[model samples]
Structure formats: C-alpha cells, structure tokens
Target: MKAIHLKTLTTIAAAMVLSASFPSYAAEDMSKMDMKTPMPDASAVTEGMVKKIDKDAGKITIKHGPISNLQMPGMTMVFHAADPAMLDQVKEGDKVKFHVEKMNGALTITNIEATTK
Candidate 1:
C-alpha cells in the first residue's frame, strides 16, 4: 500500500511539472484577437485586362497572366465577383490588377482595380 501511494504521488508530481513547463493560452482574451483573414498585398495581385463585364450576371471576364495563388496558367476566363459592386470599377479593354479565390464552388474575384496601363 505504501509503495503504491508513493508511486502515485510521484506520477502526479511529474505530470504537474510537465504541464507547468508549457505556457497556457486559456487565460488570454480571445476577443481582442484579430480573427479576420489578412488581405493580400499588392504583390499578390495578378495583372489582367478586363475582357468583359456583365453587371446583370454579376460576373467579369479577364485575360490574366499566370495566377500563382490559384496555380493557374495565363488564360482568359470568366469569374464571379465577390461583390457585384466590384464590376462597376472597370470596363472592357481596361488593364487591371485583381485577386481571385475559390468561394462557394466558384472562382470569385475578391479584389480588383483599374490600372493606367
């Protein structure tokens, strides 16, 4: 009985020491954390030309260079706008920089801006 109690106490002490060595995050306030996804920077934006804009369909067609983010080759394709208002910012034949992501089973343009070039 004495040996069993001694072994149990030793096991409990070892467990307590092991747990104390690791920092606990439970005490930290999660509400103060920035949980939103960070926006892609300018370097992540792909250069493209507006091939078409269909406001009624809430889509835009772009001829874009290789999109490294999507592992896509340079090609012309239609994309749904994450926000329909994004279509209002560009017209056909305009050079633009944009970012795309797969959302709701569709390729959606998350960001876009017309370029002087």
Candidate 2:
C-alpha cells in the first residue's frame, strides 16, 4: 500500500512539474507580446491622388492610402517609378490605383492605373 501511495505521489509530482513549466513558457510569451496593429498583406493595393510628378528624377509624389505592402500610413510621399514611361500616363490631381513594393531598397510603384471616378 505504501508503494501505491509513493507511485501516486510520483505521478502527481511529474504532472506538476510539466504543468508548471508550461505556465513559465506562457508567461514568457505574454511578456514578449506584440501590441501594435496587424500588419498589412504583401499583395495589397492603394488608391491615391497624384501630387507631383518628376520625370527627371524618375519619381512621383502621391497622397495615398495605407500601403499595406510597405506598412506605411496614408500620406504624401515620393515613390520611384518602375518605368519612366508611366509618368506620361499620370499627372497631378489624378486619382490612381497603384501597387507599391520595395525595389532596389526604394519604394517603387510597380504598376499604376488612372481611375475614372
């Protein structure tokens, strides 16, 4: 009967140790929690108004919505054009839908289209 009591104690001790270890891991995870907004997906697109166009610099400034791919908030920022010919297709005050991505370590508009509304 003493051996049975010892076995029960050993089982309880092992379970206690295993469960105790998990709480520490959980607590550690809690301590390193992320308290920021969810990140945007990589293939997201944004709508923007063309603010400026600089063909000579191969850049265009747009007041755009959140660029999910870049995690950037809506603001006026200059983005390098992937193709300079794109400049001819857009002008200031135009509403456009554009896809932005990191290219050569710069924010670049990979594809853009002028919206009719």
Best-matching candidate per TM-score: 1
Give each model's whole-structure lDDT. Answer: 0.87, 0.83
CA shift of 14, model 2, Å: 47
Worst 10 residues of 2 by lDDT: 34-43
The C-alpha TM-scores of every prediction are: 0.65, 0.61
Whole-structure CA lDDT of model 1: 0.87
Error of 1 at 65 (Å): 0.3
Candidate 1, residues 1-117, lDDT tens digits: the string is 345688899999999999999866654666667653445886677999999899999999999998888889999999999889888879999999899998989999988889963
Q: In candidate 1, which residue pairs clash?
A: none
lDDT of 2 by residue, 1-117 (tens): 335688899999999999988755477777798743232343687999999999999999999989877788999999998888888888888998888889889998877778953
Q: Tell me how far the alpha carbon of residue 76 in candidate 2 is from the true structure, in angstroms, after superposition.
A: 0.5
